[model samples]
Target chain A: MGSLLQIAVRNVVRNVRRTAITLAALLLGVGVMVSIRGTLNGLQRSMKESMVLAQTGAVQVHKKGYLKNVLSSPLHLDMEVGDALVKRILAVPHVTAVAPRILFGGMVNLGDQTLFMATLALDPKREFEVCPKRRDLFDARAKAFGTSADGMVITVELAKGLGAKLTEPAALLAPDKDGALSGENATILGTMQLTSPGERKIGIVPLPLAQHLLKMEGRATELAIAVDDLENAPLVAAALERALGPEFEVHTWDNVATFFKDILFRQDFLLSLIATVFLVLMLLGVANTMLMSVLDRTREIGTMMALGVRRSRIVTLFLVEAAVIGVFGGCLGGLLGSIVVAWLHVRGIEVTMPTSAVPFVIQPFVDVLYIVKIVCLSGIGALVFAVYPAWRASRLRPVQALAGG
Target chain B: MALVELVGITKSYELGRTVVHALNGVDLQVERGEFTVVMGPSGSGKTTLLNIIGCLDRATAGTFRFDGEELGDRDFNDLAEIRNRKIGFIFQSFNLIPVLNVTENIEFPCLIRGDPKKALRERVRQVAEEVGLGKFLAHKPDELSGGQRQRVAIARALVTQPQVVLADEPTANLDSGTSEQIIDLMLELNAKENVTFLFSTHDPRVMAHARRVVHIADGRLVDGTDSGRAEVAAVAGMGAR
Candidate 1:
């Protein structure tokens, strides 16, 4: 067995050019797989973080049938926000904090102009805790704006449409619980920017003020909950549902952001397709090279067989040669891929979509164990592709092979 | 019992629609420690006879016994075992593995049998010395002259110390002077170590060195003799001079 291994190594080294070409194929295949996986993983992480911090908290709880008519923000389906319900929610194992919010459609009047607005009324202190990055959307001057000030923060686009300025008074008009029109006066404290220009007609005000103006005191349409770990959001949501009873529906970030989830699924499918194509191409290249090597060594094989080497040994020799190429190529490719990933992670890849106002920075990363598994898989793949050619070499008749060129 | 026994050996090959008989109804016996040669022309059955005797191929119809064991129905692996333990082969092309140096090529047969490496290396060096390849142990086949390469092949054949060594026109690729040296080396090894030698050739120079020469034409032996013990003694007397 040792001598056979020696011979196999020498055989692989005999034709340096062919071996190098095969190795290059394997190297490029593995390198591309690693780099693409790392980049996709980074992209997924960035999207999930944005969705959780900028739009939805880790989980949300709403009254039954509320999501069905969510666009209308029906006040009839509102849940009572009491100390008891908040305490019950906080009792769930991983739940850290909960913020009550009222989502409603209203019209903002700035004396000369009036425009429709989608308003989210929440306890500013609690909302900041549940979604820490939410405050980053506001301008620096409004960083201290909270529950103490009786003011509203409208999106820059809405403020522009209303021709409104900060510190100016505005009238917010909407239908109260009894389907009667109600109005409230407040100061426009600041303006905020959203990721998408189409979604910039939003306004945020204090929870108490919106409840009073809508004639629904101590009630909110939903509760956005935060957990210790984002990855365990679904489990925490499940526990909240079981504890809060069937009257309320609990949703994780992914459940609420269905569009983003669909995009993620498509990305994964495309990555898998690319990986499969690379593997098949690498297999064909290796198999062709091995078959050519077998043809070239037919006479030498005959001499070995006539000298009493077994057929199984001949098969083992070829397989070992393939294995050597696999291991070497995989390691070198992995090294090169790691270097590229590290550089990209530090430099960051900024992606700008035409519909988005901000560019997303992706930081690619892959662990050492993942690289190790990829290398081992490459070695196994090479062995699998070499089986047919190795068997062909072993099946040759000594007499006929001796007569071959 | 003789070292090799064959009776009514017949070999046939199918070429498209017609059958070609390369060997027909041949009976022969070789005793232990004899240097013998089968002398025949190009289209005769010399190679087919050697192939059957070397266990590289099976006879189409015959009974063959080697060292008291019947081999007519042996499988490929079983024949491989017999060849590894009992028979050695030297090829006409001096077919040393090009990547291997002289020492590695010599030790290849023993290594295939899973012999102990340390002892096999020592035995390999001893065989190399006996074949006068002691100084060329580190030289690859491409680096050596024709005669030196043949000496490497001879050492590879002798390192296993088999009961018999078969050569199929072993000196066919060498010049006349080199061919004489290779033949003389084989004769010396045969006389000194009592190693059995059976080879096929049409070269008169090579045939003159063998103690017993059997002539074959078409497929069967032309001379109506099998053992040739008396003829071996007479030729042995002349070869010593």
Candidate 2:
């Protein structure tokens, strides 16, 4: 085995130009695969973080039928947010914090102009605890708005549409649970700069004020839950469901953002397709090199055969040659790829997604195990591609091959 | 029993629509330790006969026995094993693996047979010394002279210590002096080590050194009492033709 490896290594080194070409192909293919995977991972992670931190926390708990009628903002499906329910939810493993929110549709009156808005009313301290980055969403003027329960914050676009100014008193009118007109007066404390299109006409108020105006003193439409780790959200949600029973529905952020999940699935499919193409190209390159090597060494192969070398040994020789190329190329490519990813991660890539108002930075990173997997895949791919060529080398008739050049 | 035997051997090849006969109905044998040469013109069956006897090829029709074992119906791999265990081959081109140095090249066959590397390396070194390549063990094929390369090939063939070493025009690519030295080396090994040597060569020098010479023409052996004179005449006649 050691001698075979020595011969294989020497054979690969015999033809410098051809081996370099094959190594380059493998290197580029594996490098691109790693880079693409890392960048996409970064993009997916960034998008999920934005969605979880600024909008939905890691998981959400609501009345069993609430999400079914979520678009209508059904007051009848609201759940009681009493101290006992909150304490029960906080008891679930992995659950870090929970914020109860009242979701409603209201109209902000600005003299002759009235603006329809989707609104969230939540306790500021609890919401901040559940979604740490939520504070970043508030504009400069609203930095102190969460301190006072009577103050409200509307989206910048909605405030502009209503011709409303910060610190100005506004009348918010909505239909209460009894279907009667209910009104509340509050000072527009500040504006929020939200990126998503749906949240452009949104407003936020204190939980106490919303509960009073809606005549539901202790009820909220949903409880957004945060877990210690984003990856554990689904497990925590399942535990919450089992703890809270069938009266409430527990959803992970991925389930709540259905469109984003679809986008993620599509991205993964596209990545696989790209990876397949690269694999095929790399296979062809390595196969071509091995076949050419066999042809050039036909007489040498014949000589070996005549010297009592077995056909199986000939096949092993060629396969080992390919493996050498694969291992070297894979390791070097993975190293270079990891370096590139790390560099990009440190100096993040800013991507301006069509739906987002400001560009988000994607910090690409490839873990050690992922790089190892890619290297092994590259090596195995080379071996698979070399089988035909190795078989061809082994099958050559000794007499004919000797007679050949 | 003869160390090498061939009875009524025939070989033919199909080139397009023409069936060319390369060898026909040749019977030959050589005892152990005999230095024999099968001499013929280029179109004769010298190489085909050597190939069959060497187990590198199978005759189209014949009874071939090496060391009293029949090999007429052996498969390719079986033939390979027989060749590996019992036969050694020397080519006209000195087919040493260019990447391997003299020691590695000499030990190639043993390595292929999975010999213990430590023991085989010592034997390979001894064989290299026997072939006058003791000082060039670390030199690759390209770094050696034509004679030195052929010495490497000879070392490789003799390292296996097979019953017979088949040399097909071993000195065909060398100058007269080198060819003389190579033939002398074979004769010395044959006389000293009792190693059987069989060669297919048109070189008169090789035929002169052989204890027995078999002449062939048009794929059949030509009987002559004066084998050397007859072959010289045959060569001159062919040149005239």
What are the TM-scores, per candidate, against the unseen true structure? 0.87, 0.91
lDDT of 1 at A235: 93
What's model 1's lDDT at A393?
A: 91
Over A1-405, each residue of candidate 2 has an lDDT whose tens digit, in order, gives 677789899999899999999889888888888898899999999888888988889999989988888889998888889899999989988998999999999987765667888988988989988877776777777767678877888887888898744555688888988989899987787887774445578889899999999999988889999999998998998899999999999999988878788888999999999988997898789889999999999999999889877889888999988888888888888988887898899999999777655578999988789889878877788888899999998999998788874
Cα lDDT tens digits for candidate 1, A74-143 = 9888899999999999999889999999999888888778788998998888998897777767776556
- Interface RMSD of every predicted model, in angstroms: 0.8, 1.1
Report the TM-score of chain B alone for all candidates. 0.95, 0.92
Candidate whose DockQ is highest: 2
Off by over 4 Å in 1: A61-98, A104-119, A135-206, A226-229, A232-251, B224-227, B233-241
DockQ metric for all predictions: 0.67, 0.68
Give the C-alpha miss distance for residue B153 in model 1, angstroms: 2.2
B56-78 per-residue lDDT for model 2 (tens digits):
77889988889899988888888
